[model samples]
Target: MGIVLNQSLKNTIITYIGFGIGGISTIFLFPYILGKTFYGLSNYILSCANVIMPLFAIGMQNTLVKFYSQCKTDEEESRFLSFTVLFPLLLSVPLILIGLLFFDDIAYFLTKKNAIVKDFIWLIPFIGLCMAYFEIFYAWARVHMHSVFGNFIKEVGLRFVSLLGLLAIYFKWITIVEFIYFTAVIYFLAFLVTMLYAFRIKKPVFQFVIPSNVKEILIYTFYIILSGSVANLLLDGDKIMLNQYMAIGNIAFYSVATYIALVISVPSRAMHQIVYPITAKLMHNNQHDELNDLYKKTSINLQIVGGFVMLCIFVNIEQLYEMIPKEYSGGILVVFMIGISKYFDLILGNNNAIIFNTKYYRAVLFLGVLLVLLTVGLNMIFIPIYGILGSAFATLLSITLYSLAKLMFVVKRLHLYPFTAQTLYSIALTIVLFLLFYFWQFPFHPIIAIGLKSILVTISYVYLNYKLVISKEINQVIDNVLKKLKIG
Candidate 1:
């Protein structure tokens, strides 16, 4: 266990550092620079690209992850990489044509505004194409356990480009429409860089040779496509739907709060990039004991980090809103609802890697489809009267329900549960800290109150964790970090 953490430490730390910049960018710059309309457009465009991404790639991102772990020799790895890339190129053809033909209508249907959506409709095909191949390249990176650079590119690179685009909009160098169109272009460039890095390392050959295991590859790819598409819908479908029903600017406000909430998502994603392939390789060998220990440790570690981030956002949300335009204060509910959901999602630990890497993953697809229908239905039922808050509520309920269903499926079928005694203690600490700080509206300035509450609550959380020690593995980690900091 120590060996695994030690090996992943450098890359994981780099990835987190990048995420730290990206987080502040989302929290401070996005709302401040772009405000809500472009914010919504930014969110809307990415959601659009995400929905189309799996379709264009034919779910090769997941396929690469699952299969790459199984490849034996250098030749096998090369052929697999070639097939992954070539297959997505083949799939993108039809998607590109369909995207071009439907551009006008998709824009019209997604928003009633005069060509706001229509103006940038042309960017979707290119964006979709990028999503497909980048994953193929990123999978090449992940298979070698070289995750940090790819992760930085995957999670942070586009945002950096977007920052440039925001500058163009701010300086009037590009109109809002152009800024939106440039988003798709930025993603394409990001993917190209990833491809360059991929070749630099592996020097991928574009030739496809049939593997002895091609049958297994094809079957898993099919399931991955369905599962990936459905999962994307579960995550991004709300933003897309909001673009359709509510004002596009509303997406910006909600996105601010969502961004605050999504800070918790980064550690999970960063850690997962390293952990998934490792877990898959371990599970492939029937190393259930190692896998279980990993599950508990990941939960505690993610919670410890994620919990603090959530508390900071929870306490500072008012100032966060104060700093943003007054119109965004409506997103307070978005903060609470989305923050809790993201926190819970993080606390699930490696449940996702465990599920997606296993044989029963097809079950996740069916459940995901059901989840989409429920989410859409709920959004429809709620959005008419509640507006933006309604959208947040719908998302919160859907994610919560989806998490519960996934948990039950994993437990009943695999007899695994992420929650344990320490899990409850973490939850208890979260509740106590939140109650103390949530409604207090301290006499101090907003920043100081935020700082004090954050420090005090974090201290309380750590002290309580010391008492229960969560998992023994978790206690050891705390002790080690404390020892490094000379806290002990």
Candidate 2:
């Protein structure tokens, strides 16, 4: 718990900083500098890459986490690591070859509704390759319990580079087209840096020896690929569907609103970096009681943190939209729909980590595939009728159903639940605060209004949570911070 807290705190700070940079880039630079059309194009390319990333990596990232702790000796560990590194090439090469062989047909299909995607179609797999390897090496670091450096590169370094790319476009150093190409290069650089850092953590002693559980490993990896694809598809599939059904520019609008909503999930993302491997280790050792304890703590603590974020975003959403261009303001509903879904996901804590490490993962993967199909069908039905709002609706519905299914599966199968009395209290607190502050606004500039409102909300939210003692861990964190400030 100490190490989880320590690193999760650092990762939270780093993730917020990255999201801060990304927020600026998304809210200010991207809309103003890149313009809506090219911005959508950029997002579309990345979304496509993300959607296909699992297929390329072949789930080695998650496999490494689930299986790494089982290695009995450093020799076995090295062999397992070697397999994680090299095994993806077996699939990636063939996939890339197939992509090339069918490139023309693929390009035509994707570009039928939005031709702007045609020219950058090649970057999808290229960037997906970079993203795939980055995650693999990132898992390499996570399994070694060295997640902070990798997290920084992932959360901050990449966004900072993209910020620079935007600045380059601003300064006439690169065309938008060149910036698009540079985006792929940025991912490649991130992959390179992560691989090096992972090596620095534990210099890879490459061995070709497959683990004794090769059959088990392969089966896990295969199911994970489907699960991973399902996850990515849920995250970015809306944008990809938007590209198919509407103008490319609509994605930029949707992206901005979704990015705001995305900030609510930052705590979960930060915590998951470390918690995942920890969760894997716990399940591997058959530590059921300890695992259930972790499940409860993670859920409540993340709810407190993520709920605060959601409250701020939801209460201040109107002003935040005011800061962006009016053309993008229609996504206000998109923000609400997506924000609720993300917050719902946040409260589930390490549910995903728990599921992925279990034997029933294959069953869950099948459920996920069915949900993906449902999502696509929903998008096809709703997008044509409701536009980006419809896409958001589809996402919200699918994600809610999927989350409920996962939660039920975990509880019914493992007999572990993530919620307790504190969970109910935390939800009530969030609702009370949201209702109290939402209708009120500072009569000032959008920046000042947001700042003042956020301050008030933060103070109220923290004080109430502290008084309620909704989570002992969270209360302790508050105590430590106050002690450091000599104000407790």
Clashing pairs in 1: none
- Model 2: per-residue Cα lDDT over 321-383, one tens digit each: 998999999999999999999999999999999999999988888999999999999999999
Compare the candidates by TM-score and give the number of the best one. Answer: 2
Say which candidate scores most in lDDT: 2
lDDT (CA) per prediction:
0.77, 0.94
TM-score of 1: 0.92
Question: Where does model 2 exceed 4 Å of error?
Answer: none
| Model 1: lDDT of residue 442 | 69
Every model's TM-score: 0.92, 0.99
lDDT of 1 by residue, 78-110 (tens): 888888888778767776777668876766786
Q: What's the C-alpha lDDT at position 19 in model 2?
A: 99
